[model samples]
Structures are given as C-alpha cells and as structure tokens.
Target: MKAFDQLYQKHYPTVFRVAVKMLGDSDEAADVVQEVFLTLFQTMEKGMVVEYPLSWLYRTTLNKCIDKQKYNGRFQKLETAPEGQVEFQSIEKQETRIRVQRALGKLKPVERALAVMYSESLSYKEMAEATGIRFSSVGKTLSRTLKKLEAELKNKKYELY
Candidate 1:
C-alpha cells in the first residue's frame, strides 16, 4: 500500500501526460491513470516480480491508450472529422493540432505510440524499453515512422487544415 502510493506519486503525472497526448482527452486520460494504478495494485497483490515498474507502467499505458483508440475509433472520427463546416479553429495553433491528430490516426498503433513518445522528447532507449522493441532499432524505426507520417500529412493536402 505505501509502496503503491509512493509509485503513484512519482509517476502519476507522466502516466497521465502520456495518456492525454495519445488519446487527446482529459477524461479518458484520467481513466487510463486509474486503470494503470488498479492493475498495478492487483499485480502486486498477486506477488508478481516486477523488475522495472516504471517500464511496466509505460508499456501498460501505451497498450491501454491504443486499446482505447481502437474501441473509440468511430467516436473519434465523428468528433474530429471537421463535420461539414469548419469551426473557428482555422487559427494556426488549433489547426495544426487537428492536422497532427488526423495524421496520427492514420499511423499504425505502435507507430502512433512511438511517435507520441518521441514528441514528448523521450530518448530512443526509453522508447525501446517501454515498447519492448530492440533498443538499437528505436532510432531507425522512429525515423521511418516520422517519414511516413510526414508523407501522409503532405498527401492529405496542407490546405485542408
């Protein structure tokens, strides 16, 4: 109990930020944080040996965020599809955010997760550790993923946003 509380205090902000960045929703991010802590408590209760709890939490958060996107695909599309008319979000900052989100949607789940982590300035080693990908391949994979995302954003036409 005390250990879990200490873990939560140390990592809650980062976990919540990762969730919000991936899912783009405050409520859902909060839910992910709660779920992660609950799972941690349950696993510890079962006496599992977690060698690296922070890495485990990162992996779990990414998985849950991806699953949430999968489950809410339709709702997400409906929310971000710009409807028939563009709202007042044509201003540069909001427009760029929407464009980025759209491009992210087109990426594979792993790519999306990696890209978001990269955007948050996580090191390649950290990303690889969290994702279980080969450490040496993290840089190459992230570069390739970024190139793909850039191409997608370009192909979608910069004028639309």
Candidate 2:
C-alpha cells in the first residue's frame, strides 16, 4: 500500500500530462488519471504484480484516452486557426497545444500510444513490453505514426514557422 502510494505520487503528474495531451481537456484528463489509478489499485488488489509500473500506467492512460475518444467522437473536427487571432497570448499557446492534440487525435490508438511512448524517450524494448508488441514493430510503427502526424499537420495548415 505504501509502495503503491509512493508510485502514484511519483508518476501521477506524468500520467496526467500524457492524458491531457491525448484528450485535449483538463477535465477529461483528470477523469482518465483517476480511472487509471483506480484500475491500478484494483489490479494490485487482485494480486497483479506489474513488472513496470510507470509503463503500465502510461499504457493504461493511453488506452483510456483512446477509449474516450472513440466513444465521444471528439476527433472528427480539427480546430485550426492562427493562434495570433486570439485576444490573449496565452490562448495562442493553448491553440498551439490544441493543434498538436488534434493532430495526435488523427492517429490510430496503437499508433498514438507508440508515438507518445517514443516521444517520452521510452526505448523500443520498453514500448514492446508495455504494449505487448514486438520490438521490431516499434520502429516501423513510430515512423508511420510520425508520417501520419506530419501529413495531418500539413493538411491543417499548422506550419512550423
């Protein structure tokens, strides 16, 4: 119990951030985080020993985000307007974040999960173990996911400049 609490404290922020990035809403992200922790607690109660708790938490959060997106169909629209048009500069930052989140939404759930894990510096082996996929597939999936994201961003007129 103490160990689980420590683990939750250590990893909750990262989990919530990832969830927010995936879901694009703080409220939904908070729900996903809570659900992830609750599920973790249930699994632990059932005597499930996760080999890599961080990876497990990340994968769970990613899955939860994907599930929510699927059920809500929130990814159908791409809200892309110039950030500068917003009244506040802070809204500009938010717009940029939303653009990125919308791009991420276009990816398949597995692809999104792989991209998130890779972006977070998780190695192929770690991703494989966490996602139950082959290590060799991780590189290819990540490459394809990146290409898809690039194409989506281009279509949305979100240029780097």
Candidate 3:
C-alpha cells in the first residue's frame, strides 16, 4: 500500500501528460489516468507483480486513450496545436491542424497508435513493449504509418501556400 502510494505520487504527472498528449483533452486525460491507477490498485491487490511500472503505466494510458477515442467517436480529431502566444501570419496554422487531424482520422487505430508512439520518441523496443507488438515490426510499422500520414497530408486540399 505504501509502495503503491509512492509509485502513484511519483508517476501520476507523467501518466497524465502522456494521456493528454495522446487524447488531446485534459478532462479525458484525467479520466484515463484515474482508470489506470484504479486498475493498478486492483492488480496489486491480486498479488500481481509488475516488473516495470513505468512501462505498464504508459501502455495502460495509451490503451485508455484509444478506448476513449473509440467511445467518443472522436478518434479523428487531431490534437489542436498547443494553445499559447504564437505569432501566426494567418489561419494557416489552424487549417494545417485540421488537415492533419483529418488525415490522422483516416488511419486505422493501430496505425494511429504507432504514429503517436513513434512521434513521442519512443524507441522501437519501447513501442513494441508498450503496444504489445513484435519488436521487429515496430520499425517497419512506424515507417509505413508515417509515409501514409505524409501522403494523406500532402493530398489534402488545405494548402497554406
């Protein structure tokens, strides 16, 4: 119990940020994090030993994000460009964001997950472990997914030029 509490305290912020970055909603991110901890507590109660808590948390958070997106039918919504003071000459940024989100929406769920994990700088091994995919497939899957996304983005009509 004490150890679990310490783990939660130390890792909660990282978990929440990962969720938010993946899901694009602070409220949903919070929900995902809460669900993850709740599940962890249940597993611990069952005497299950987690060898890698961080990896477990990250994987769970990603799964929760996928589930939430599917449930809300918002899997297609690209995360809005970071909100803050940024100089922009026009609505190009917003249009680009929309275009990207639409293209992301076109990807199958697994491809979307792969792209997100890859973009987050997760290594192939880490991505495979987190996604429960083969380590050898991670590199190829990510490469294909990126190419698909780039192709989709380029083919879209949202040109800033």
Number of clashing residue pairs in every model? Answer: 0, 0, 0
Q: For candidate 3, write residues 12-130 as lDDT tens digits.
A: 98888777656655777888899999999999989999999988987888888888888988753354554442246257766776566667767876777777777667788888888
lDDT of each: 0.80, 0.77, 0.78
TM-score of 1: 0.80
Local accuracy of candidate 2 as per-residue lDDT tens digits, 7-86: 89999998987876677666778988999999998898889898889888977888788889888776642344323444
Sort the candidates on TM-score, descending order: 2, 1, 3
Find the candidate with the highest TM-score and give its number: 2
- In candidate 1, list every pair of residues with a backbone clash: none
Give candidate 1's whole-model lDDT: 0.80
Provide the lDDT at 156 for model 1. Answer: 59
Q: What are the RMSD figures for all models against the true structure? A: 3.9, 3.8, 3.7
What value does the lDDT take at residue 60 in candidate 1? 96
Candidates in order, TM-scores: namely 0.80, 0.81, 0.75
lDDT of 1 by residue, 48-124 (tens): 87788888888999999888888986327523534334465566656666677777777888888899888778888
Candidate 2 residue spans exceeding 4 A from truth: 76-92, 158-161
Candidate 3 local lDDT, residue 76: 39
The candidate maximizing lDDT is 1
